[model samples]
Target: MGGKQQHDIRHSDRTPAALGYSMPPEWAPHEATWLAWPHLASDWPGKLDTIRWVYTEIVRKLVPGERIHLMVRNAAEEARARQYLHRAGCPLSRVLFFHHPTNRSWTRDSGPIFVTRSQRPHPRAIVQFHFNGWAKYPNWRRDRQVPEAAARHLGMPLFEAFWNGRPFVLEGGAVDVNGSGSLLTTEECLLHPEIQVRNPGFSRRDYEAALQAHLGVRNVLWLKSGIVGDDTHGHVDDLARFVNRNTIVMVRESNPRDPNYRRLEENWELVPDLRLEDGSRPQVIALPMPAPITFDGYRLPASYANFYIGNAAVLVPTFNDPKDRLALGILGELFPDRPVVGIHAVDLVLGLGTLHCLTQQQPA
Candidate 1:
């Protein structure tokens, strides 16, 4: 850990990668999971109350495996959350509450991205990326403070990522890593020039350099785009994810007329050509997309690829569709170490995200 000014890596060579730190795969053991308690009614519209219970269920499932670092706005909010968790039979002692206010509850996009070093005294550190509500929403000022607060709370060294003297903007959901130096992302999220542009004027090379410096990535696999109605533009977690170092689970839409059919197919075709960090081709498995879910004239991003891998369980979002069982069975085979649990996410997706989007894992 360094002094406040020294932590900013804009003018220094002490990047996380330079110090041997890399973002761990989600399947790795976690000390705890960070979650921002849902309080904003605008995000879930008419389902805010229902969404809190969803949080309780998630906590109940995860607490047996890892601690829950839950952020709440104030004492009242914490008390309300406690009541819900208590009734749900979630162990209260396993949860640690922080009075950290946030505009939204999606921690994957706004929270600190923790990286780890293998053989160091202080192995864990926080790589604080500049978050701007995914560069799509205006009410992200509070969300931006989450990383710094997290770093202080955990007593971990904080490294501020910057490119060309400006803070670099990135979201956790924008990239998925294999913990073996390979990363998966979509061009629509990082390269699209005019649509929800993050770090304007940054090219592929610039992004690659920044990613290598911060996350220790040696290879980047770029997908064409994401499914329809994803507000984050093209988050990769909604389309593809690394189940293991050598396997990637990607979503494929069978319905030819579906809006995501072509986009997913184009990405699926590229998978065979992609290589892992060690120059070996990764095993690609196809995951089915749930039928289009429409609410208030909006088609929510409801792909099964947005599942979260927890230490106790692999939580997959289920939309009460016929494909839910098939998706769970596929994931169950891939993750034999942990139980594959399907989380009811119809109301959760009304906020435009589900399991993986709402949670961020803290590597142990």
Candidate 2:
């Protein structure tokens, strides 16, 4: 592999897209899945114990499909995670633990965005973009180190993403790729100035250019906003996702009185007119939103759209709502080859995210 040689080259001079690398679709075959073990009590507060159990359940479901590479703070944390995994009956042979400390367990935002180039000397590499605690939260210094540590551990070349000669901030959950030159994102997350000022003075056109240069995408479909309770401003993973190159699974709220109803409806309307890279419109599938889940009067982000697609199964976030079964059935039809397993996410969402928010896939 040209991993060492590519590491010597300065990625600051060129973008990953110019180097013939692009982010793959989630449904693609993965070598492993990366996760950070939940350790911070402040993230879950009163629900930490239940949240730990949910994390173990998530590990149990994913281990059967692909290797799970977990990040722990230290040897003690690793031992604790091992005990939990063992009790959960996860296949120990398929799991590996790394001593990488993180402030929070949400790996989707802090983790490296893995890219691939079929003809390159080193087929696999990673894009390390700046992360600023979603531009709202603090205590992210340790979380920011995750990408470089992960790249070193995996022996993959790491490329730093920049805009106007400065590092740019972008989370993996903020954008979804179709692996066919089309990208899906929201204007609320990337373009919202006051909410999450990711890159100062970056406009919509500037973002599109940066995405094309870094992600190798020809078309970008921007939704207006996300659901009501999404604290990351508006992560597209909680609102919409690309199931295939020509299809999208988006969230839709049925009850008109709900706060998310209007925004989701507006986003749903835009999908039919959205064109793909090939100039053909994509097949839009509307996924149901679960009933509002609240703790201390705050609505948690509990959309089924946060499901993670793995090699052996599609891990869905299921709230104990009537719509959970409906969402599973719809996704089951979409991913006929993979088993649709619902991991109860009522406790997981207490941290404001679910399956897709906690895991990052490494393409094979």
Candidate 3:
């Protein structure tokens, strides 16, 4: 592994017409699931121990099925994480931690976007992009520089973009691809000019062009909003997710009084009965949203859409509400090969997020 500052992963020698970089499916062989060790007690408040247990349980479910690539900031956190994994009886060999520093444990949104080629074997590279704390959380300078460290540690090449010689803003949560060209995202989060500070030269077109070049995305489907109380404004992950090339499971609200009922209904109508580049409308399914979990009168973002699909099992966030079982049943049907396990996210959401918000999966 070698250290290089802001290494560009894209080779300028090839044109988009000449280059053949298609986004591989999520189920493609994963080297390991990437994660950041939790440290900030401020995010968990008094129940940090319970949060660790839940996170440890997540590793327990995933490590048996596949490898776990974790990120630890310091020696103490690393030791603790190692202890938790050991006690959980996870395969020690499969759990490897890199000393990459991060501001928080949400590696999925902040970590490197690792994409691979389907034709090639064991080819893993990282995509380095700019993260501005969703333009909400202002203290994430260290978090923004994660890709450089990840590239050096893994000895992989980096792909940095320069469309219009201007920077682009995108989060891992804001976009989900079906391994084909079509992608699912929210216009509220990605295109909100007032919500984000963009480079003077880059427009929405510039951003889409960059996506085409970097992630191999083609047809971009724009959704309206995510579940309310989400801090990232409205990341698509909390509203919709692509489980396979031709199937997507979305979160829906049934009660009229619920704040998300109308927004969720509109999103349902917006979901296309259309096809992919392969010409097949994705099988659309619905997973009901759990009862709004609140702390001190303020509602926390609670949705079944925040499930993290791992190699072996899908770790879904449960609110201990009635909808928990229904959500798991739906997810289980979507991922028949993998077991659907639920984690009580009632306490977790007090931090303004759930499972999907906490963990990021690294594709093999």
Candidate 4:
């Protein structure tokens, strides 16, 4: 029956896994990085101007190694972004703008997930998972159009993620892959039936099957929870990330009295026990958490684990805390070949995310 079932599933031959395609890790070579220009005033409220400057700086740093495919609301917004990029001395030749309108600036969640296969008439394709504004916010109708827009722009074939003949809702930030066959995610994010309820009736086995069928992952490592202030409930990108195929960098809090201490500690405890598909344990590194960042009595999710790995550099978010330098130094040692650049994210976190939450890489 197992053999027959496998043959029956392979008869369709439409899934990424069926075609030998897989989502590569961030450290892999990339064709470009995708970002949505910050336009909606409601997202950052009074800090839109400052956030625009932040976006410009991020573009300046990224243009040296690879192209940046930026999205704008319209022609006017594109012209404004062009002016800012010119002033920031960005390499205009390396940046391309798309007129795709987005409800928010977080392209990491709404952007296309590019997958690649070795042999091909088509080596590049996109997995368009349904986005529902993290299951909390509204005004996401425009945001939902981003993945299809990106696929059309690249002229790549689109594969929609579905289960039981229903569209499956998933945010890219909820999971991290090692480019091999292992995936890292949080139970609090994907398995909680009531809270953020991505797929209401999906169980742990259901999620594992879906991941294996679409992302080509063989092992699913689950962390118990995330930090205290993450609005998405528990995104693995904010708690832990794979720095390399065999190494993981997880956030650790030393102060027991802090609100995030217990939860982060529990997640860290699961690290040593995790093994890859080869039955080998990965080397776990402890990255220090910055002092809590707050704005208007609200705790912002300021985390060092939210760093984005680009083709030529790793952009680490710094919160003006004392541990910022410490985290940079540690990452520098870990990634000797790539430069570790820190971006001041104190203001950026006011939107409840940092570097990794804003950009998505396109594999070269």
Question: What are the lDDT scores of the predictions, listed in order?
Answer: 0.93, 0.89, 0.76, 0.88
Q: What TM-score does prediction 1 earn?
A: 0.97
Q: List clashing residue pairs in candidate 1.
A: none
Ranking by lDDT: 1, 2, 4, 3
TM-score, candidate 3, is: 0.92
* Model 4 weakest lDDT span, ten residues long: 1-10
Model 3 segments beyond 4 Å from truth? 1-18, 118-122, 197-203, 272-275
Best by lDDT: 1
What does the lDDT come to for candidate 2?
A: 0.89
Candidate 1: tens digits of C-alpha lDDT, residues 1-364: 4555435532465788988899999999999999999999998988899999999999999999999999999999999999999999999999999999899999999998999998756688888798998888899999999998998777787888898878899999999999999999999999999999999999999999999999999999999999999999999999999999999999999999998888889998897799999999999999999999999788999989999999999999999999999999999999999999999999999999999999999998
**All candidates' TM-scores?**
0.97, 0.97, 0.92, 0.96
- For candidate 4, write residues 64-161 as lDDT tens digits: 88999999988999999999999999988999998988889888888888888898756877787889999988878899888877776777767788
lDDT of 3 by residue, 1-364 (tens): 3343323234453323124565565665566777787777887789888888787888888887778878888788889988887888877788887887788877778888776664533256677677778777876888888876777777866666446665566788888888878888876777766765434445677667777887887877778888888888888889998998878888889999999999888888876754566766778899898887777787788888888887778899988888899999988888888888998888878778887777766676
Ranking by TM-score: 1, 2, 4, 3
> How many clashes does each candidate structure show, in the order listed?
0, 0, 5, 0
For model 4 the local lDDT of residue 278 reads 81
What is the alpha-carbon RMSD of candidate 4 to the true structure?
4.6
